[model samples]
Target: MASTTSRHQVQDAQKLYDDRAAHYDDSWHPLFAHHMVQLADLKPGDHVLDLASGTGLVTFAASMAVGQTGSVTGVDISSGMLQQARSRLENHDLENVEFHQHSITDLDTLSVLRGKEFDAIMCASVLVLLQNPGQAIKAWAVYLKAGGKFITDVTHPASQISLITFERVGRGLNRPLPFYRVPFQKPEDLQLLMEQAGLRDNHIVSLSQLEAANAGEGIMAYMTDPAHPRLDKLYTIEDADDVFDKHIDHWAAELLSRPEIKNEARKIFKEEWARLANEEGKIEEMDCVFVGIGTKVG
Candidate 1:
């Protein structure tokens, strides 16, 4: 909603998530959602809103916390993700949990949500993906009842290895690449973000753990897969060859015009990924996140 570029980014992100929906729960993503829900400390009969609730991770957790007296509404932009969520919902008789497909930025425009208020609103692992997080927070606060809380999180700047490496490689090449923004470098940045959004009495908590990650294979897929949706913004995928020049941006074409430069860049990207691997052929993934909670001002 901020600009044409922002809209395109959101669309491309939706595609990326849709592509990731099937295997999303195979990782530790659900663990963070549950932890955030615990920090929320929901009470029975409370109505909760989950923004960008992919696969109902937060929604289902909050659903259990709030119990049968309350309801949880999960909203997301990707239909594929929501389909997976809805299927999971079928396995459990959670009448209090429901999912809607809608962009979080447009929540205020929806007839069902326009005048409705929530006891708390939670957005997990999604703040950095927004084009204007502060603006989105301000809009979301309007739907929170007076004194209600808004809960969200920002991961440590170096949290996701493959993504960080992707950005680094793009910077090295001086080539334009679409990447998610990492806005919070420390707890104070998140506190300031909440304060600026008109939230009060902000509380911040840190969660961290070290885990093994297959960074080598992940980065390789991004660099080599022509059909990868992560490159949707930079390339046109039409069953084209893997050669970078044929489908990638003209800038990529210009770079690949020199065969030596192309090979050098490719080698650098691959070696960087390899260099990150440990003795077990995996990277030590630092899973760090800062959860921020703030009450809506009256």
Candidate 2:
């Protein structure tokens, strides 16, 4: 039983992915490919299912690994994204891969795939976006054959410094930003969810650890970077420069108003701004992703 709010979220997510379909792979592929490839772990002649398979990043990779004898089916809610995926498959002459349009939240919609089991079910970087990730995970596990593997990844909130920084600044200005539509979860929470879903021998892997690092580019550059997959979803303001400038000004003013650490805050602010301005500034933060794997119990 899904909540009304969750239903609305599904609509929103579908729109977002559809809007981003054309450019989704361009930014996301490089960042997420390594983890997806590693977790797919497809052997020759193995069957794989790729849920929310935007642009077939993992789908194509799995197809290659499975070789000619194996098959890969990718399902996504966004028709635009599926269209791109289909084009890729046709262009590559990949006969072993296929695509279907289906919402992850609607398990009933997956009835077309009923009576089918997979050697590996991979849902990369998609669980966090769901309105009911736990429920979805449980549903996905049913498609796994006994002893088959279930794999998914989520962005760890702590490592999302930009969003955290924006929220802090927004709060200081008394204009709190909206919480991310797709909220993150702690590693332990993921483990518990998997266990509840009847997946055994759970394992977790972190792709990158957050650290004090600086990007040599300014906030605008960083936000607009084509390489960062999350940019479009996170930065929705029409004029990036104007919005970022106001945020910095207000944030700086708030910092200066504090008596105890005004001086230190100003220094830190200047350094941060300078770092954003510099294309070579060492941005001291790492994006972290947690990949969880579990085996379906008999």
Candidate 3:
């Protein structure tokens, strides 16, 4: 039985992903697909399940890895996302993959998978969003055949430093930023979760990416960008500019308080904002991902 908080989380996730479905692949799918494919280790003629398989990123990769004789089933909560996944499947002319609209937290209710087992189960950057990731992992493990593999990935804590930087900036402004929920904060945490879920011989691998320089854009545009799912939860469309302005003002004020580098800091800040407004300026970002692989050994 899902708790009230869990239910609300699911509803919120569904709405967020449904709205984000169209543009999700443009940004995140490419990053996730690479790690998910390697962690899943799909074999020819294997039957695989992909939970929270958004836009068929991992599903399509698994489909190709499994060859013609194998099959892959993708499950997701957002019908909108599944719709996009189905369209992509058609575009690729993939015959061995199927998708179902279902929540990762409610896998037991899925009729198609009932009384069936899979050679592997893969989830990509999704466990952290669930209210009860442990229970969900345990439930998913039941569908795996004995000695079957289960692979999942989560954002490494080091990769989340950008959010921490934002939080600090918000605090300097005296308006605390809302922290997004991220469950697996450390590698050990995910390892323990997998063990508690009855998975054996767990392995954690780190995948890191160093992005090329970015042309920095306006803070407002960055915040309200359609691909940024957290925007709606953090600020309203109408007051977003006001909120951002306030933060920028406060941040500038804090920088100006320093005597030694005050002038330089102010100049850099002003120039940066100017460049951002004009959609120019170099920005670099990096991400670290931890992929966890375990097997259910009966």
Candidate 4:
């Protein structure tokens, strides 16, 4: 099976999320909230910013933790997603939370926040989609007051490849996609960028709920997209392996419908996987990723 990872990168993740707005909470809120609360350390009257604040889950979380005296700003590149956030806020009548349709990479926007640096700045699932993360982090540093916390969660790529060992009809198995290990900018890379960007006091934050089974109902919703990866014209047998390799848990679960159906499908997949594990002795398992936190020093 030929690799199709390079081609898969062209997919617009932001647009995909925008289309999944209504289902966003059901699909990703759980998967995302696991490592988010490092920003909750914001003081009672602290100002906080959620970069790439998709669907406002993090902003809402921050707002709740920040108390009535505090304020939270949610910013994202997609206006559609911001609409969902705005709607969610209005529904709750949360005046402390605000939304901005802006690019996280824009330096001018940082200027707009002039002297308005926050006590914390958080950029989550958004970093993986950025074309320039170091610059983006630098912008966050500029937007944060000295000693302000900067936090973000990064999916452990290594854990992903270890989970979904893909097999092509011809190539047999274990030929996972290469991109599973390719981080847009890994934690180490991100740490370097942070230091260069004037963010200091860096540390690996707490590990959130690693397994989905440990996550809450809301977050479970976000990871519960029942749609297949649609490995059609673009994704190859190899690509499918990588697709499974990277998003195996989510996609594999999507293969089922109701609970009864999930159990039935899991029975089949589990048995098949056992054959691969026993006879071929090659099976993949799921893993955990971490959250990183630091302070803007300059």
Candidate 5:
């Protein structure tokens, strides 16, 4: 993460994530399966690293996939997120997961660990938020063993069309939400970044299929966010109300209980996402951005 690219410091991002930690797993969070499916391809003894392992989402999932023989170390700049991650792991009784509070982009110090290289590194939705993702990728490439895979999953630029961005979506609603994008950052740009970082055997995965499976519709459904349907599956019927009450007024939020508006919104979204689907892969496939196993080129 670059000082200039990030308007919010690590502490700030961590703090924001920490606030959502308790409810993080409530909904299906379609992206969860994105990395899980990819990492599952690795052998048990493989070493893995998750950059910006916020609240242990990727780390926790990776721990289960890697098993005991494999080591999973998560590096992030937020202590709050690390603490939450640690707590979640302890609750799961996972002993193989290790987390260090540090900036993952330029990992100059291993005072935190003895290993110098990882078999695979997963960067989940963290690239565009950085100051200079290309440089960061190059710097972090040193930690990869030869043939190691560097995977990055980010909110697709095509996402702008559907409205997955919170700030932008917020404004579209009656209430104005945060409107913004850091600028010059997109999955396409990051793909170029992987090349500059000297990574090879690179394949970009257009992550789709989660809309009907988990969460609700495509990533854009998060745009209107009136009902905040993302949590539809992650929670029991008991705590759903509290989650909505707390979050509905937050930003591009919508309360789905309103009989008329809720039904109408659902209809519109379904029709739109469905329409996007029938067109084939033309106007960007309906899914988040994903990076397949990335090999270190040099």
Candidate 6:
């Protein structure tokens, strides 16, 4: 059973992913998903489960790996994301794949998966979202058969410098922002997590890809909107004018109550963003992903 806090976190995450469903694949997640599938080393006729399977990037790839004999079940809390996955599934010939609207934290309640065991269970880039990731892993391991594979990944703490810097600046201004991502600093951290979850023969590896983005644009987006990663394609700037105004108003009233301090903080924050954006006209960072694979052995 999920605690109240976990339920609320799941709900918030559901909305977050739902809002970003249109633009979720715009980033580097697609390529990472394929890499996660490769790490799984799935075989034909291997029943697989993809947790937090957003947009079916991993689910689709896993379905292909399992061929026609094996089935792949995808579970997500966001219906909007699943809609995209299902839409793509309609046009594809992979009938062995299916998506369900459910939270990974409460997988035990999913009736479709009851009494079922999987040959491999893969959760890609979603551990940071959970408040109690170790517990989730332990629960997920129960669904894996003996000698089955359990694959998941975590981002290096140094990655996503923008969000980290944002939170740091916010704290300096006496306005703490909750980033809600676990700072996994090394591969051993994830390996130990799996081992504590009753998994064995753990293997951990790091992969990095150079990623570049317009820092100024992203900083402005984060400043004006609480939801920094907005679906710009789905909602134009003009269309989101009201949302932007509301967020700004809230920040002024709640985050920075003092007018003088607020003005000074805003100036400082803008300057920091400008400095970051001025770096070669864009921010280039290494997107380091640590992949962890373990075997569910008795």
Task: Choose the strongest candidate by lDDT.
Answer: 6
lDDT of each: 0.71, 0.65, 0.67, 0.57, 0.57, 0.72
lDDT agreement of model 5 with the native: 0.57
Model 2 stretches with alpha carbons more than 4 Å out: 1-7, 162-185, 209-285
Backbone clash tally for model 6?
0
Give the Å shift of residue 182 in candidate 1. Answer: 3.6
My TM-score estimates for the predictions, one after another, are 0.72, 0.68, 0.68, 0.65, 0.63, 0.72
Error of 2 at 265 (Å): 23
Residues 123-185, model 1: lDDT tens digits: 998887776788889899888999888999876654665455444455566542345444566
Q: Which model is ahead, 1 or 6, in terms of lDDT?
A: 6
Positional deviation of 294 in candidate 2, in angstroms?
A: 0.9
Candidates sorted on lDDT, descending: 6, 1, 3, 2, 5, 4
Any idea what lDDT model 3 has?
0.67
Instruction: For candidate 5, write residues 1-298 as lDDT tens digits.
Output: 1111223445445655667667765755536544443543666888888888877787777777788988888888877667778887778877788888887755777576555788888877666556566787898788888888888755544454334333332333332222233343344555677877888866555444244444455443322221121222222223323433444444233333244444444444334434333233233323344444468855
Worst 10 residues of 2 by lDDT: 218-227
**Displacement of the residue 18 alpha carbon in candidate 4, Å:** 1.4
**What lDDT does model 4 reach?**
0.57
List model 3 lDDT by residue over 197-266, tens digit each: 9999997775544332352432122221112122112222233234334443343233333455334433
Q: Alpha-carbon error at 230 in model 3, in Å?
A: 24
Question: Model 4, 1-298: lDDT tens per residue?
Answer: 2222232222354555667777777763544553375334667888888887888888888887888899998878676677888888878967788887766767474444657778888877656555456776777787788878998755544333323332111012222222222432245755676778877887553232333454455433223211211111222222333443344445322323234343443344344444444233543332334466888765
lDDT of 2: 0.65
Taking the tens digit of each residue's C-alpha lDDT, what string does model 6 give over 1-298?
1111113557667777888899999987887787778878899999999999989999999999999999999999998899999999999988899999998999989999999999999998788767678889999999999999999987665566445444444556656443434346567888898999999999875654432245343222122121122222222223222322334344312343345455654555555444444234543333466789999986
Residue pairs in collision within model 5: 5-131, 26-234, 27-231, 167-178, 170-177, 171-177, 226-254
Which portions of model 1 show Cα errors greater than 4 Å? 1-7, 168-178, 209-285
Q: Which has the better TM-score: candidate 1, or candidate 5?
A: 1
